[model samples]
Target: MRPTDIDDPQYFHRVVDCQWACPAHTPVPEYIRLIAQGRYDDAYMLNWESNVFPGILGRTCDRPCEPACRRSRLPEDKPVAICRLKRVAADYRGDISGRLPQIPAAKNGSKRIALLGAGPASLTVARDLAPLGYHCTLIEKDPRGGGLMRTNIPSFRLPEKVLNEEVDYILRMGLETRFGEEVTSLKAVLDEGFDAVFVGTGAPRGKDLDLPGRREADANIHIG
Candidate 1:
């Protein structure tokens, strides 16, 4: 998307329409304006504050902002490539190894919690829990964390380096992670010193389709 894609259109028009499109309600036109001024670092930071996964979003987001582009219906039938532009901005300056926000010191001593999975939900829960003064220990069976993100998602979609880097940033927030040990049973984890045990182990078992009512001969076919 060109600078004109946002700035040339009246500022009010760009802001009002684009804001409505973003699910996270990120300041779309503001970041685009910053990019137009070559303040790429600020633009990237702004996007990251609202959505931590800027680079991931850049690569995989289903962009709704493009259709909202006022440039549409003009001489060119094409709308501004908002997704590509966001990716460009992020690609240039989304590095946060040394610049990530520091976790605050713990207030009243809180009990420790053990997290049984290191997937997104578990990781996000820990991230939200850590700053609140709850010490969290994340356990994963794989060599590295990121359950489905590391295993199921193809490398072409999410590069290992990018995923690792982002996960590292979150880990730097003072979470303790142990890899290669599966939580075979809840009995041991709770028996240990853990104050609370959270089992985020995901989708271990698929629903059975061989039941009597679910049989193909009995009724309509259902794919689960």
Candidate 2:
């Protein structure tokens, strides 16, 4: 056990298991290591570069990285609580309002994109693309944005206020959202002067299991 390893078991494991995790291949250990050292601003920026919803993920990830934690071999029968630790770091950092990580401002006059939907992918694309001055218009038919986030998902599992705050911040960064306007077809958007359009309409249906003689089971069984 090295000097750094003596501090916290969770922190120690996060440093070692970070590299193989992130899909965007971000410097995971570097940011978490920074958090361990109390260098919060740098950690926030480092985490946000690849994953803008750092605060959200910190609180609500399925935590695949935890299973990879080196401390799982310990007697506790659980790995380092990386997700909760991330939430602790983000919570202490206060509001990240208007202080987004620095990126290139020049547009280079590239392609114009019309993104239809305000889900996670749409939000991520908007966050990255809009800063570059790309003309992005996120259209949704619902009264509010956030796709499944605003609806379907229960408030207890995922707090609506937190979701709204993060979504609002992302939207403030120049992602134009038009409500109650459903694009029935892709051709409509392209015809309206958009060079390209990205659709992110997620799954809007659910399936039911058809077990034998289960149809009337609910009606017959009314427990007191």
Candidate 3:
């Protein structure tokens, strides 16, 4: 390892393999231990600080940590329930809505920023900046705020209530929202005099193919 890697605290922390494997580098074992100790509030807050959406990801995260688990490599052993454990913390926490980070009132020095999309990335940016007295304007094309989360993901996997709760919590930052407004021009947004702009235009449209048999009747095929 390089000198910087050696000096980094994560190098030591990485001994807990689950945390090292996580894309967000969340302290998986730390939070799990907290959960086991019945410190649900602390565990949830730790998760919130690390990934910002414990409840949402607890339900729908594609677990990269599981396969990297060192325990799994051991004889007849299984990986810890890192993702699900996060849900245990979120689900059993004493306070529900109160855990959300409060947005500060914009003072004279508040910065005005424009977010190009209302997807997870842009929303996360707003969540971080809003607390620091930034005015966020989320420009979206969809009828509702969530970009692909609401449009693409099946309800069975990620319930609407959970997604909406998290999204609404971020929006509660006094961030202005423009619904049903699709952005086609960047110059127009720049001309409007925003200090900064963040574009998080999520995945493009799904593939559409024109197969042979030419509009055969009695075929009920769905594209998505």
Candidate 4:
């Protein structure tokens, strides 16, 4: 029998149309409450637990939660600014390494997993599994590790410092990263003795626009 996709259990909660409509089902109100009490570190870590990168998503996300924010449904009401509050927590938090989960050494007979790409997906996998004693290796085709964040995204929207710091946090887990490496065959990596391999090449490309009057005439038309 063939398998099919299933919606994430958290998707239902996200559809509840509250101010906390995050991809990871973060408890937006809880963290905001923490921040209100001056528990910046706790708020930051709370976001980190679910969304992983509060600062990055706080900066770059399209703000899915805003549209669903219940406050705005009221007459002459505005949302609680959920996205910006995440940034505030990140901005004022103390050192987070102390709260990070304990990571085991590389030689613990742990499984050696190879991530096929170095985008956010691969990095997040590395982040989650590294602490669980998996020796993660990232294979990226770019000169650096941040993939689209380092390449396509403008640094102004998500600053280089923020991206670099977060990526470095994942790297500090002692995972190996090979830059400018393209893996055409998963068999080759398996043959070389990787116990498992996961590929996360980001979203699919957008369809080309072939309209008659507005196709490729202008040099300033961008299609990201």
Full ranking by TM-score: 3, 4, 2, 1
- Model 3 backbone overlap count: 0
User: lDDT per model, in order?
Assistant: 0.75, 0.71, 0.82, 0.82
Where in model 3 is the C-alpha error above 4 Å? 1-14, 203-224
Q: What TM-score does model 3 achieve against the real structure?
A: 0.84
Clashing pairs in 3: none
Put down candidate 1 lDDT per residue, 5-107, tens digits, no spaces.
Answer: 5333355454567656777667787898999998777888777766666766777778987788778868868877777777778778745555566566873
lDDT of 4 by residue, 42-132 (tens): 9999998888788888888778887888889899999888899999998898889878877876544768899988888998898898888
Q: Superpose all Cα atoms of candidate 3 onto the true structure and report the RMSD in Å to 1 decimal.
A: 4.1
Off by over 4 Å in 1: 1-17, 73-75, 186-224
lDDT of model 4 at position 130: 89
- lDDT of candidate 3 over 73-114, digit per residue (tens): 999999877788888897888765576677666532767899
Q: Each model's TM-score? A: 0.69, 0.76, 0.84, 0.84
Q: Provide the lowest-lDDT 10-residue window in model 1.
A: 5-14
- At residue 92, give the lDDT of candidate 3: 86
Output the lDDT of residue 129, model 1. Answer: 78
Cα-based RMSD of candidate 2: 7.3
- Global local distance difference test of model 4: 0.82
lDDT of 2 by residue, 1-224 (tens): 55664345455345656444545444556777888888776777777777676667776677777777667878878876777766666666756665873334654375667878888778888888777777678898887767877776678766777678767767877666798998887777878887678888875655555778767786774334
